[model samples]
Target: MTVILKKVPESEKYILRNFCSLYLHELSNFTMNLDVGEDGIFHYVELDNFWTVDGLSPYFIQLGGDIIGFILLLERPFLNKSNDYGINDFFILNKYKGKGLAFQAVEKLFKEKQGQYFVIQVAENRRAIAFWKKVYNRLNIETHERQDIIDDELCLIQTFKI
Candidate 1:
């Protein structure tokens, strides 16, 4: 299958909304709680209410003209000691897993963009940590240090030098 990556558009917002809603629903069911955090500090994220139009410049990973995943990125901060370009909320549909498509997509991102580093934060839980490690290892990405924790969940920060 051919995967095409493109910037997000108005027409595709509904598709993104639907996909995230379903993903979060599944996550909630797996966690047995809608709140993704404990100790009264929950991550108040409504899938429908997510995705800021201004804060994020979104991109969709489309295979055979079908959107299978998305990635969000932020501009690199000027004062940071290390190279770090923010990446958030990357997800691929379950049907497309294990195809190496995500690796290809990220490789393309580094190839096309002039950025020096690609930074992403993943929850330090089982599935997410495993997935991120696998992807980064497959893509030969590495990190210098771990980032902060969010809502009691260890947030793993990885950076890929481009």
Candidate 2:
């Protein structure tokens, strides 16, 4: 399978919307929550707007002319920054999961900007923690906690020093 990675352009707005919706739905299902209502979809729209703004540098992973995944790399206040690089948001469609596409996306990002540290925040729940731990451990990237909180759920920060 040929995978194409390109910066998101205005023409692909619909693909972005679909990708975000499917991704959020899958995540909500994984958390055993039916909370992804209309409001939730609207929330993703707002996030998409922010990421879609000029200079944000959103990217999409396309397969056979269809967008199957996306990775947004932008600066945010809450995340730790190293030389202005942060692994902001990365997700793939459920059908495309477990195929090592995520690892490939991250690996490519790092290779593009060599020696820049990349960090991803994982929810402090069982599934998220396990998934992140497995990836970072296999890659042998140093993991460090910046912040963690448990309100209705738990959240953990996983940092990868590249």
Candidate 3:
């Protein structure tokens, strides 16, 4: 029942790459339309940037001792904002869903990183949208939402200041 967000180190970047491929595969069900390349792996082009970039934090969602998924956090402003942070990616394995672990993990993160932040979910991903809605409601925080085009696809962005 112990959910933790373990910060990933540079030497463990490969772990993020491997898990992100699976995360993307799971996301393919929700309008991601991802495809594996000739190498037979779903490559995340920005995996390297998480380490090299100044304002990015990558984490592995762990339950006790086992790694279940990951969350990628980005700092600096986005979506035309001057000072904001963002949840770049979040995923929990199917087996881990509906157990309230996601809420605990994110709540713990919000407690540690307090600032203006936004999270974007693909417009077609009702599951993601629902999850974020529940998160905000449970956190009891006010949020601003809008529909916007990102990477040429319609997305729902939720902005909040904690």
Compare candidates 1 and 3 on lDDT and give the better one: 3
lDDT of 1 by residue, 1-162 (tens): 667789877667777766666556545543434553454333435433335434455688888888888876554443254554566667788888788887777767766764545454435345756776776677676655566765454566766666
Best by TM-score: 3
lDDT of 2 by residue, 40-159 (tens): 561354555645454356789877787779977764443345535665567777687777776676667766755445454446335555666777777777867666553344456665
Runs with alpha carbons beyond 4 Å of true place in candidate 2: 30-34, 39-43, 51-55, 76-83, 115-125, 150-153
RMSD of each: 5.1, 3.7, 1.8
Error of 3 at 128 (Å): 0.6
Task: Report lDDT (CA) for all predictions.
Answer: 0.63, 0.63, 0.86
Steric clash pairs (candidate 1): none
lDDT of 2: 0.63
On residues 1-162, what C-alpha lDDT tens digit does candidate 3 reach at each position?
Answer: 789889999998998898998888777776655778788888888889887877888999999889888899988632245445789999898899999999988999899888888999989889989999999999898999999998777899998998
**Between the candidate structures 2 and 3, which one is better when assessed by lDDT?**
3
Range of the 10 consecutive residues with the lowest summed lDDT in candidate 2: 75-84
Q: Roughly what TM-score does model 2 have, to 2 decimal places? A: 0.72
